[model samples]
Target: MTQQPEKEAIITVENLEYAYCDFKAVDGIGLTVKKGEVFSFLGPNGAGKSTVINALITLLSLQKGKATVAGYDVSRDPQKVRESIGIVFQEITLDRDMTVWEILEFHGKLYSMPRNERRIRIEELLDLVQLRNKRDIRTKYLSGGMKRRLEIARGLMTRLKVLFLDEPTIGLDPQTRMRMWDYIRKVNKEGTTIFLTTHYMDEADMLSDQISIIDNGRIIITGTNWQLKNTLGQDIIYLETSDNIAAIQLLRTLPSVKDATKKFRGILVSVHKDGTKVLPKIIERLRENGISIDTVNLKKPSMDDVFVYYTGKEIRDDPPGKNGTLTHRPGGS
Candidate 1:
């Protein structure tokens, strides 16, 4: 049997740090993104996700540590790094007056792509994004989802190795967000390595090949979806009992119970052993103690659970405009 070759790292960082005067936006952190993989920086707002991306894309100058993108050092070869990657900002950046085709065409031109090549690429991208019919319509007339698709199309105008998407599906409806996710999957399937940052739990859960959870300017954890969840325990059991306080205290004494936390109506238990076996023991113990079980649920750990377990708080999705830095243009302008 032949051994498979190891995947190459397309992006690499070492002790990377960035600051805004006195405030450190990104602490001494390090990460690696492999070729043809959808790597995500998952974090809440103000976690320095955008700052790391900005530096990689050459939008912000690196102050400390070493980093490389597409085989070029970001500090020494910033332009090469920019040329090797495409960017889709968190906010919509289309010119209200420009047509879909015009938006893509302008991008290709701005990068000095040949006239014939630019036209051909525009046609291909329009078809790829499923916007052929809306090619000539002004962007102001397009819906939110349509505008997002257009931005993605513009990002792919050049033959690039990586695409940086900073919260690509932020303000869309649930249906549109799912649809956009499909488009992103298609892009990855076609062999473009993706590096995206997002606050949405489901977005990271569904889209990432590998996820790095960042908070307070530091990376708390990094792993595949299942790998991260597995850290919590074998299974999770949510129990609501008549005497919640008494129940949680009793739950902690069980050998199978790894840990327990008091919830509003009940207590959530993380067990090291199979929940089916551990569950019966829980019910029997509670019944023996005269505590009545109101509700019981058993499931595997989810990304939400993993996040809360590490961060010690629930992740909240910030509303679009509350962050103030919500609106951003491509090229870090």
Candidate 2:
């Protein structure tokens, strides 16, 4: 009957806010990331994800509230916070002319890593990323996946308590993204806390120890993937009927039906009881009301469903000035 102790927080934010001129990008938001976990920030583009990250990593000055990373205050000890984290940007940032080994080696030097230490870390990372054989190849010659691996490797050149991965696999193919996930898992197992922002729902579902979904400069929900999905109900039934609006309204009248939301082409119903039991009732009720059912799909809730249920829309590409990017230096200055 004993409660478990809370894990130590490696990153903490309290009523954090940031704005671009008069436009507020990050509203008063607060959350904590425990040590040694892959914590994902899931949001549509321009959802203030980039702004919050930029603040936590000390790229943007804190305009209000507080944030601490690796035990250093982002506002007061920005340099210390920077030194404790490594960043992999959404865009590929390697100098095409530089060799793989040189990219990592130069990053180590930038952080003032000692000569022997830099060499040792370089070898260790190249091996870790499976780029040992291509160590001497110029980055431009590498495939997209290879370039991503190199970027991850470069980020780890210095010893870090946390790694900030911004859209880490944005442009990679599915198979390569899976491979990158493996590398990321290995890194997390090795004890570095991973703070991830990603566009892929499957990516967040598969890799996150915890997830926070942000929208319009605010966090909509924060929980494990299962926790978030469970909020919708035991099962979800997607229905496309002759009268979608009336179908959703009648669905809400069922005692077993938890809630229903209208989708573009259908309505999604969440059931408190077994969907099989609820499904029959749903069809009969609609029939009584003269609503013809064209389609009915039953399944467990997914991350996509959870996102839509809460945000009322699908994730979209960020528009300019909503979540703008800056060229990231591998290790913070």
Candidate 3:
């Protein structure tokens, strides 16, 4: 007999669907996270990333198909799903008046873990997230970075098989965000399945083992970060200035410009798919237009570029659909 794996899949989603009033939020979505992979759901805002997360955790009722977290069905066995998952919501969930240690301890008791085990887990997690020194401080007094770190510690209090983080470092500084990535990597290395959603391209690129780009309540693409990167036809050139009309005119004459759109006072221009080979020409054309450049950035086509290419909108703009409250679980944003 072939020796099989012992621990079963930690999460399964199949043909899942959800709608708010007349509009669907998640459309026939499906995914499965193995025992220890860091799987990511990425999208423009309001693309139903929250909707799917909510369904998976059993916070929102499933409108179609099925999902199982650990071994329990999402619709029929929500409590079981809850038992196996720990969540760090987009909206901060820590009790502001409670000390960091106190919050983790309180959350641990809710999961019915033994006192000894909970203590050990909390200590270990605090160190893992680099928060051992700040454990006694009340959450409200902590800096945004510190509070985010404490939330990581709290999320691990339950010894969860699946960890869900939604936009984990939205407003953090670059250093803090990078440190958080390191901590998240540490968690996945300890054999927990990490699931997260982010609108930030860099965060998704740096950490996700595989990424699913969802738009308009449906997944537009799903693959490893490299896979998605490789799929893009060419690189992108981004230009920012204080003149929208001038910015558009600046890019209009560039033979390499495949597409150009005015964004506020600036214009984001896409080079021809094969135009990446002629990078110098792109710049010369801009200079000819006399568009005084405020900022010029070179970027490979990212998940965001891929989303905009298909949807014709920026990542932050909410899609046209029935609006609904986005709650990924009980203590969520």
lDDT per residue as tens, model 3, 108-213: 9998999999999998888766788888989999877677677766776765788998877766667767878887888888877889887667788888887887
Q: What does candidate 2 score on TM?
A: 0.89
Per-residue lDDT of candidate 2, residues 175-201 (tens digit): 767877987888889999999998778
The model with the greater lDDT, 1 or 3, is 1
Model 3 ranges with Cα > 4 A deviation: 1-10, 128-134, 238-276, 280-299, 315-333
TM-score of every model? 0.87, 0.89, 0.74
Model 1 lDDT-worst window of ten: 324-333
Candidate 1's error at 68, in angstroms? 0.8
Clashes of 1: 0
Candidate order, lDDT descending = 2, 1, 3
Candidate 3 has an lDDT of 0.75
Each prediction's Cα RMSD?
5.6, 6.3, 7.3
Clashing pairs for predicted structure model 2, backbone only: none
**After superposition, candidate 2 runs with Cα above 4 Å error:** 1-3, 114-117, 124-134, 141-143, 316-333
Superposed model 1: Cα runs more than 4 Å off = 127-130, 173-179, 315-333
